[model samples]
Target: MNSESSAQIDVTKPHPARRYDYWLGGSVNYEADRASADAVAEAFPTIHLAALENRSFLRRVVTYLAAEAGISQFLDIGAGLPTAGNVHEIAQDITPAARIVYVDNDPIVLAHARTLLDSSAQGATAYLDADVRDPERILTHPNLLATLDLSKPVALMLVAIVHFLTDDDHPHDLVRRLCDALPPGSYLVMSHGTDDYLDIEDRAETSAANQRSGVPFQLRSTAEFSRFFTGFDLVAPGITSVTTWRPEGWRPHPRKEAVSMLGGVGRIGTRAVG
Candidate 1:
């Protein structure tokens, strides 16, 4: 941890990143984070499964973009703690020269930025201490420019983060601004929380629990989440539950309702979707 970011670390309050880390069985969380995570889990018993499935969605999508879509550059926003399989690790494994720029607002993430910066000999990685709400800042940041060439196709990773932004934040416009900055062929890979899969009672309970957990969360419906991909062409198996989004072969997959998170990949086209 750098001296600057060390001063910003507040263990007394639970941060979304640390809370997520706790859910992912990471040891970098404080008591407050664990308590908050447990509180949400009490209402939605599958909360831990959701987190793990979301991580799996990330790995699968990165593989598709690198191995199938031929995308070599990535701009991953809302990147959480340094985990086992990160964007660069998976992308670079397939395409050694892949470059990635990660963005996150958490001070703890900044403290562990070094873990994200370890890139392959043929690739590069850079982390920015920034928030998704300010897409302009992220898109225009010097670090992003230094690492990625915006004219080419770059996979924009927004996994499990936009739920933190309520309607008041105008999340659509923020996402549009970032996507607009990228040229055609750039891809948008996203996984968002949705209440559409839950029963009315469970939805209400989960919403209330999230409110009390000290983390901002808003679960959008499929239609609402789909609006974020207005100008891009969705890839196959479009906008399905994360568990069902191309799950590994030959095995029975979890039911969509069980996870309650929707994910999709969209390719930027020369013209908007009509």
Candidate 2:
């Protein structure tokens, strides 16, 4: 691990990013994250499957952005620890010249992201230690601008990461500012948590449990989620259950009682004809 102050992993408290890594069975998490995740798993029994499905969506979205959207550059905001089929890997698979810039505030993730730098000679990858609240900083970050040409169309990925931002953070405004900075034809791909498919009591309990765990989650309504895509044209399927968003034939038959996660991909500004 990079022992520099910037790369010192904060293992003392429960971090949402690290807890997410734990849920995905990665070794980059600390005891605090594991404990909190275990508590969350107890509250929502299907959390493990949900995490897996979210990661699957990340792969699908990146593949679509690179192949269908013809976007050779990507800005993955709130990127967690590097894993299989990461944005650079999936994007480069379609176009060898794909360039990816991962932004995250977690020092541990930043340390592990050094491994994500080994890209094909035709492609490039870099990580930035930046927070999502500062869109300008992320846009102008040396690592990000060096790898991705902001002037060209780029896919902005915020998968399974925004729920961590509380209302005080003004998540919608943050997204709007970021989108405004991008040129026409840029894409915004997102997956968010919701209680739309959960029962009344279970939803309340889940919310309470998350609050008690010190990472309060905000599950937006389908309409609230769609508001983030205001200036964009949604793709064919539109916003719906993440599990139902282009499953690519690997459908997990959800229990009728399971709470659904909301996911969708939208094309920002002009629609790019494939």
Candidate 3:
């Protein structure tokens, strides 16, 4: 756990993080990742739109958190392979001293995290080879300790990650534990997949296809996803489609239900859990 050699990359088995990188058009993916993604696309044709929309929402949320909400620190759990407009870039672009820590368990992502460490002189950046399931490990990691101030308001970003936590994992409790560590006035910028738009038949096919590929994914309902924000208050455009959340004039692209997801930025209260 202390060394990079601890977590070895398995090129033969596809990882969700790598598959996501592939969807975002980053070259840091393998044939297994591409094949896994292609299978998902075959089940859900407009999967590309989902990837783009999630990234777009991340842009708006980060901008709002740094520029408007005045959050100076960000803890992005399940941080996938870095691409355009990463959390540190967006936050530091607005406030040069903003600090960011990227948490991920993917060996490929952990290996490539050096690219994510190029921070502005005024800001700080670090990466942790930690799993989201182990909230305490991530919260107390030396990298996080060096990069972030836990007493200050920090944005806990779980964008496009919870769906990978199967029902048996108690992902909502996992979310609560992560959020509980942040101070008051902090925010949870979260997004999740749901079968809200997909028909029951398509949903079944999607789940079956991913199971065949050994992907641990579970699609929840809007109410189920909303429970992750139990102790907080949602920003305007509460829990709507990714493109519909406080959308800029350019959002809600022609792809309608293809990018279907419920996303929001919720402000935490004084207590740990509400």
Candidate 4:
């Protein structure tokens, strides 16, 4: 990590990426992150399971894109800590020449980006330290341009990241801007936290806990989450809980309510909404 970026990292405050890393049983988090994660876990005991389920969804989606959809390029935003089954790892495994660009605002992610940059000799990887709110910056980054060709089909990955953006953030516009930059035949892959499956009381409790945890979280309903795919055509098994989204061969899949995350893939058609 460069001294400037290292100086920007405040271990005293809890960040969403670090807290998620904590829940995923990664050792790259600090006490603040662990505390925030534990607070949410107190409200939703299955959060750790949700994290694992979301990770599995990412892998399956990437496999479908690379192996089936013939997508050789990927732009994964809100990329958290590097772990097993990274985008480059999964895509390059299927298409040896697959190229990936990972974007994240977290300084900690930047620090560990070296791990993300280790691509298969036939493939390539690049990481950009940028926020999701600034779609233009991510879209125009020189590294991204060099790694992915916007004219070709690319997978725009927004997994488990948009929930951090509140209504005030205009998350829809942000997503649209990114999608608009990709041409027809591109794909949008996303997984988001939702309270749709939760009972009234549990929903209130979970919302309260997330509020008190000091991390910005906005859990949407199924309809609200589905609106994000307005311009594209959803793939089969549209907008279901992450655990149930093509959980191929995984035995005893957990109940959808247990995971509480909605995931889907959408193919950008020629007439896709702007």
Candidate 5:
């Protein structure tokens, strides 16, 4: 869609994209988003930490993909509002010609695409109003394929978004279908929410609150998160806390909260699933 058309996107419902933007301290969120986020936050106090760790994971994994894995094209599925150090920015910094396609069903994301998420002239960026479950639509979307070459190795990032898919959404099968379409040497980067560290009552309360918001939030176990990366070679460190995966030198702040999120990056190859 053109810039003018994209501006007509809905601003009413509490979109997950905008709620996430608010969590990241961005200004693109609406009141409804703030309300929804406030409710979720009140129930799950660690959400803020999860958001930070999740974003950090995105940055670290993208850097690894571009610098070490030598990938130039990125397909960021369910990509929320473009924030600091987005996929293209990180990748293009390492390889100037890196191409990226940011996919989301939220219209608000598209409205801000050309401005908030501009790409370097040497590289390319595009947005699509597509759902995560619709792999074929996303893969075949003209705008997506225009910027990304499916034939070549690409990093398919689904960080912090799969949990938005409830059981009926069949998130596991959806991920597998998307991976099956990619060529060997491609990669899948995922970070999912979990309740492993929470008490039973807290977990139940948090789950119920998320359900009330019209968006079903599914928190999986470490093993469950790993299942999404099946049929691929897990990168060094495998699935672990975001801080533990390729941790930088700076010591992390003392934990005021507990962490229940699990994340990791995996590589695809011609051999059997890793």
Candidate 6:
């Protein structure tokens, strides 16, 4: 990136994506992000495990999308700093013809997304610098258009990103707008953090810390989070914690509920399109 663009980044403040990278043991974060992430870990010692389980959920969902659902294209919005088992990796690993379009607005994330652009000989990859609040922009972006065919089913991946948006952001509408543009057979694969499982005080403290960090975090209830799939058909083991979402015998963390994030994969209703 040019110096002018780089100057816009304040390394002194933590970014949600970078902080997540820190928790996932990625080397792309700065001191500010690490410090904030450490504080979150101290307050909720299971956060790192939550991050791991969240990524694991992404892997399992992507595999199902590619191998079972026969989805060959993915629109992974708010794709944080790349790590192992990324959407494209898991998708293309199953169907080498899979194509992926990753969207994010973080400078560091944009810089690192180049790695996400690498794909198998039979597939393709693309990156777009866009924000989650404006799903229209992503849906219309030239890169996304070039990489994915909206006329066909796409696995829209929103893993662990919606929590960053507050109620005022109308995240539900934003998500709906994105899904509305997809064909009827498309799927929505998402996970969101919640305060439902935490003590009131613990939830308050975590919310306060995140607020002070200049990053908004909203922990919703399971019912509220499930609203994201209102018009779709949920996969089996629907709307459960990421740890228990089709466990597939992969339990990488203890006290799974401490992760406190719910995930589900929902296929857009094919009957609705006619």
Clashing pairs in 4: none
lDDT of 1 by residue, 1-274 (tens): 1112434788898898999999899998999999899989999888888899999999999999999999999999999899999999999999999999988888898888888998999999998888999888888888888899998988999999999999999999888888888899999999999999899899889989998898889999999999999978899899889998989987777777778999999998986553
How many clashes in each candidate? Answer: 0, 0, 0, 0, 1, 0
Report the Cα RMSD per candidate. 2.0, 3.1, 1.9, 1.8, 2.2, 2.8
Better of 4 and 6 by lDDT: 4
* Between candidates 1 and 6, the lDDT winner: 1
Show where candidate 3 strays beyond 4 Å. 1-5, 272-274
Q: Candidate 5: minimum summed lDDT over ten consecutive residues — where?
A: 1-10
TM-score of each: 0.96, 0.93, 0.96, 0.97, 0.93, 0.93
* lDDT of each candidate versus the true structure: 0.89, 0.81, 0.86, 0.90, 0.82, 0.84
User: What tens-digit string does per-residue lDDT give for candidate 2 at 1-274?
Assistant: 1112365666888887888888888888888888888887777988878887788878877877787878998888888887777888888889998888888888887777767676778999888888888888888877776777778988889988888788899999998888887889888889999888787988888887787677767888898898889868999699988777777875555642353678888888753322
Model 2 residue runs over 4 Å out of place are 1-7, 255-259, 270-274
Mark the regions of model 4 whose C-alpha exceeds 4 Å error after superposition. 1-7
Better model by TM-score: candidate 1 vs candidate 6: 1
Could you say which candidate leads in TM-score?
4
lDDT of 4: 0.90
The best candidate in terms of lDDT: 4
- TM-score (C-alpha) between model 2 and the true structure: 0.93
- Indicate the residue-level lDDT of 216 in model 4: 93
Clashing pairs in 3: none
Model 3 CA lDDT for position 126: 89
Ranking by lDDT: 4, 1, 3, 6, 5, 2
